[model samples]
Target: MKDPMDLDTPLKPPPAPGSDSPATAAPEARRDRTAPEAQRTDAPKRRSILGRVLAWLVVLALIGGGVWWFAFRPAPEMAARGGPGGFRPGMPTASPVVTATVEKGDMPIRLNGLGTVSSLATVTVRPQVGGQLTQVAFTEGQAVQKGDFLAEVDPRPFQLAVEQAEAQLLRDQALLKNARLDLERYRLLVKQDSIAKQQRDTQESLVQQYEGTVKADQVAVENAKLNLSYTRITAPVSGRAGLRLVDPGNYVTVGEAGGLVVITQVQPISVLFTLPEDNIPAIMARLRDGAHLPVTAYDRTRDRVLATGTLTTVDNQIDVTTGTVKLRAQFDNADQSLFPNQFVNVQLLVDTLAGVPMVPVAAVQRGAPGTYVYVVNGEDSTASVRPVTLGASDGAKTVITKGVQPGETVVIQGADRLREGAKVAATDGAAQPAAPTPSSEGPRPQRRPQRNAS
Candidate 1:
């Protein structure tokens, strides 16, 4: 065991391959001590703090922007400049109402009526004598003249009767001549005492009675002639014939109670109408002043004029029951627009005024202080409250007698939510406003502040 190998072991394996040198350990110790300190010193910590601060600033900016926008924006129903149809709450809205021009032209005061057309002359055709109807000369609906024969009665019996009466009259006349000659002879004999006085007087009385008999025979003959003439029925007046009420061979008679046929005149016709009593004064004044009152009738459904005429006559008194006054108008029946009992609406123009101021009735508002209108004024087109006096109203338009001018623009449909001096926007792209119009009334066409359109 005490060999050389044992001696090497006892020497500790040659100092464990230079473990006794401190220089080598020094390098490892320096590395271990400096590593943690270098890591601590070189780490970028300030960058992380700056990143958190930047993120916070961005979040604050976003929140501030949202708050500012929510607080300052206008509400939804309003428009720019606080007018209608553009943008914010409590602003005006587009109106659905219709409007008309404030014209500076004639304004006619009128009286309207309802009317019907009828003929001037009408007649009924009937038999004048009692007889059998032998012939019908006219058709059922034929036009006739005054003397035209309408029908004929059987003439054989009437002719025979007339001849007999004539024969009797001639016999009476011959007897009358013989009696006169006899009376002359008797008078001469009585004067010569050739005959008694009683005899002469008796002869004279006989002659006078014969003369009366001849006169009576003549009258009978004339009556028979008249009866014969009446057998032929003629039209009493010229007119159009209606449907035949009797046919040929009908037993027509003078005693027949009812009418056989009716006839109506067709040429120049007339219309009867009535107007409310409220329109009477105006119409009468115009008529008295020599103004021609024109009247028109329109078809019911289409509102087209079917006839036109002038006021011919008016009733002396108003109809108290209907609160209406009767009027009659004459029309030329050239187009035959008028028919008997035809119903029509009538527009009677009583009078007209030149250069009168009238506007759409929709612009007139019934305010607390009577009637008023909203007039747009200034360069901003702001609404201004104006009191107005109204004249005649035609349901669609009103005559403004005072307060507003002719050419001024009045707010028609945009006044419900509007206040005085609030802005406006005209729908025809004329949003650019003009100056205020002058205040004078009567005939104003294209006011002084009329500006060029947008």
Candidate 2:
């Protein structure tokens, strides 16, 4: 055992070659060697403990920073938008909008209906007598006047009949003349008592029979002449002829379904249109006053005006199935603008409201508040919702019966997203200027030209 309090410590020599015995050393030498190994092991443990402490400290610092940011920091968007925690609150936002001025104008009330062009007279030409068609005098599609020669049928048969009837009439006339002379002689003989009374009566009866035969022959001759005239066919009405149904050299008969030809009078044409039954009262009232309501016909697209005319008459009864009534309008059609069976759009100027306050239709809005408009105050540059009483609208402009005055500006576009007192930036960027206020002059313009853009 080593001394407990040994002060002198010495180093020990290493083992020699070939020495098998385990090497032994003084207590101090052994202590020095073991002390270095223990010191190395303990150094690593201290370093590991110090590193763990540093890792825990860094994690705690990150958690503290996240808590502060999530709980105490303000949102960037809210700050910029000027909310309670906003960066700016003095500036106000204005909604962009387009505007127009209200003006007093003549608003015409017009009714529109789909109509079809019809001919005043349509005739199907046919033969009155049966015969071979020898000649077609009129060309197809040719405009012919009434009584114009159209076609001719074979006249040889009719002419022969006329000759035979005339010859029979001549023969009967000679016999009748002979009988009359005999009857006169019989009467003279009876008066002189030279013959019996019964003989004179028999002779008189024979004379009457001959006269009746001559009269029958004369009737046959007139009938044959009338049949001959029928061989020359003529137009019954003035119109434009259609395609010929029966060509020359073909046999035709009377009352044939497929007639010789069809003719339509287009010069003074008529249009048949329909209107709702609800409109009958107003139309009848105007008609009773002898008013000739003007009507305009438009093309299929309602883009071009084909012709203009006056309302002529209304149908006597309404069409119950469709709840509509038929109306007829007449046009001179001098230029042949309207054709038979052509579909068209018709506009009837019913009545014109004169000198009424009007505004663009786009300015009108319907919402929780029945009908309203956004009236823009020029001085404050703000928009306000104003309720209005509407009268009539011509698609482009509407009549304001109440709640709006002339010379005031109203928001025509961008009324959405607007509050009662919302600020607005108004711009007058419409295609056409406000319509001209109507004058009590000639007549009210039925429709506003499509040039007015909202």
lDDT of each: 0.73, 0.86
Q: Which regions of candidate 2 fall more than 4 Å away from where they truly are?
A: 1-98, 171-215, 377-382, 423-454
Candidate 2 local lDDT, 58-79, one digit each (tens): 9999999999986775322221
Q: Encode model 1's per-residue lDDT on 1-454: one tens digit a residue.
A: 5677764555533456647467678898899999999888767687788889999999999999999887764322344354465445455443322223467866766555556677787887777788888988888778788888888889888888889989998998898888888889989998999989898788888889888988988888888888889888888877678888888878887856665778777656777888788888877887899877887765543245787778888899988898998898877766877676777667777777777787776688886867888777637666778899998756556788898887787876756755656566654213435335332122111212335782
TM-score list, all predictions: 0.64, 0.68
- Top candidate when judged by TM-score against the true structure: 2
**Worst lDDT window (10 residues) for model 2?**
440-449
Report the lDDT of model 1 for residue 88: 57
TM-score of 1: 0.64
lDDT of 1: 0.73
